[model samples]
Target: MMKNNISYIDKVRENILDHLKTYQHSETIYNASKYSIEAGGKGLRPLLLFTALEALDTDIEKGISAASAIEMIHTYSLIHDDLPAMDNDDLRRGKPTNHIVFGEAAAILAGDNLLNESFNVIAKDKNLSAEVRIKLVETISNRSGQSGMISGQMLDIEAENRKTSLEELESIHAYKTGALIKAPVLSACIIAQAAPEISERLEKFSEVIGVLFQIKDDILDLEGNPELTGKNTGSDAKKGKVTYISELGLNGAKEALAKKVSEANSILNSLDELISTAGLRKIVQMFAERDQ
Candidate 1:
């Protein structure tokens, strides 16, 4: 059964990749965007989007476009994040950074292209209700806008090489990392037109997963291999950025990570829903043990 779910997810990824191939209207930007998407991550956001939708008994067709849109937004962020102005990274997902291969200018354009196309992907989907699509788009804009992911990035940049309080650090991650992680769960809720009470529960559940994702990431960066993890490690320490490990200490951060994962599972178990939560449980375990 788990193997079936994994195959299902792989098929979804192939669908996503195939759909990306159709965006060839602009030769350069299209190629660049495709390149970034092809240079894979775990495809966690889209998986979460669909998985949550399934768990909520939402129509998967109506949610697939939104899932693709979420993946696009994530890819765009990665391109910009590896830019010379940001992390200045030379490698991503075990390949040369987008900017490095395409040149910084084209990579920037590619990121912008993905960001805009994300909206188009959602808007053009005829399966989802216009109202739900509108809400999804609005949510994406707000979550990715100045008040959300971008704000977190700005705060993180400001916090670099400085002593930051635990509260401040959490604020940075909640916006920067948590917003995207939360986006899919929220997107699923929107597709389902779930009651406010149910959406609120999933929101809290996703929040725990999002921060745990980052906390585990911080631990991995400190302890993971550049070869296996697909990029340089020790970047946090090198950049003098404060992370969960920095704020809570290694053992302390591990404790916190475990606690959050436990909390997320408790919420998932408590949710009023049907269909197997086996997929989500597997994803959580992956995050907890991911090498990359």
Candidate 2:
């Protein structure tokens, strides 16, 4: 990845963390939410939105609240995903999970709080117009709610101890994982008021990247360094969750990841004249090759 693009993504992640802390209130639940947000992650969703907005020649400032909100939503999902009723994980980002420190109920409340606060952040941001804010809320809700992330999650739960066809597996990821990823890309387009054709292309690019994200995660689970990923490996196999690696094997998954990276690059290159693509191209490389 290019140094500039890496620096840009890091800068955005730092700013989101700062925003999360700044908006935190004086309450125990707030502390729980803050703890999860500060636990640290790729912050890739928010970063993608901001970078896409930049590429679209829009004001990055207008996307900040949305970006931060997306990160909060992502963190909230992770918190819930680690609960006893769910993945039953005790670690996240190499730290005690929310439920481990706070009670399970409190952790659930914290996740709920974060999900609500994410909308509050978006709805309250004065920088964006009402039209833009409304669209942002709609996209986030539709994508992260029952129809998107939730759907994928439910499918994942159902897939446990059962064989899933490749198409079914893709459906699970597209919803559970791809929906949120698509939101940021679409949000940028909305805030930018991009043309229909441009928006369509970017949407397709987002979908590819979204699945690639999951594929890479699967590969990482199989071979990634725990020190870097901050999570244990082989949980998918242990849990009998269907993943790209499980279906395609290591070499096959890597090949698919490479193909998606190429597809993403092609999409971005085509849009370079419309938006500077250096940032996104670098991101594609990073995602395809990331060890964590």
Candidate 3:
């Protein structure tokens, strides 16, 4: 099963690269964009989309374009996030950040290019129905737009250097990180045309896992090995950013992470009778225990 999952991820990467080939009209912009996209991150969002599709008993192939689109948006966010004006990191995925290699201006444009092309990819996909494609575009835009990820980002920027309550931290991540995490799963449901009840349950499951993701990230930032994570540890604390570890303490954050993992498993159990939960259950475990 793990090997199959890896193969699926490879397919997603290949599809993303194939789509990027068409955008090479400008060499600099293309290289900047491709450099970040090819960076060796886990590609979790697209993996979640594929997992959800598999559980829905839909052909994962049908989700390839949508998966690539989600990954492009994710890569774009990382490029912008690593800029001097933002998180300002020197390394990402074990190499120099896009802005460090490409000029800041080019990196910014690369991010913009990826963001714009993501919607076009969905809109022009021939495999999905017009209605499905429209819905995918709408869902992605809303989740990654002002009311979702961007709003969360604004909240995070505002909270910096200030003591944030648990509620405030959760609210910030729910928008910034959780919103995009939810997007891919919801996109899968839309593509699968699953039953309304099933989709609703999966939506709740996605919410739990989204928070789980951020909590684990907080722990990893503090405790993970830089060699494995491909980024410096303690950068969050250096930035005075409020994370689960900072707010709840290290042990407290681990406890919270454990509870979320349990909640995710319970949700998967509820869906066992309706669809194959094996893949999603593995994903939940991966989210809970990943070192990078």
Find the candidate with the highest TM-score and give its number. Answer: 3
TM for candidate 3 is 0.98
lDDT per residue as tens, model 3, 38-59: 8859989888998898889888
Worst 10 residues of 2 by lDDT: 1-10
**After aligning candidate 3 to the native by TM-score, how far in Å is the CA of 241 from where it should be?**
0.3
Model 3, residue pairs in steric clash:
none
Q: What is the lDDT of residue 184 in candidate 2?
A: 92
Off by over 4 Å in 2: 1-26
Maximum-lDDT candidate: 3
Query: If candidate 2 were superposed on the true structure by all CA atoms, what would the RMSD be?
Result: 2.2
Model 2 lDDT tens row, 1-292? 2343335555545655565567767478877887887787877887788778878888777787788778878999999999999999988998989999998998999999889878888887888889889999999899999999998999999999887788998999999999999999999999999999899999999999999999999999999988899998989899999999888999999999999999999998888777788878867877788877
Better of 1 and 3 by lDDT: 3
Taking all chains together, the TM-score of candidate 1 against the true structure is 0.93
User: After superposing candidate 3, which stretches have Cα over 4 Å from the reference?
Assistant: none
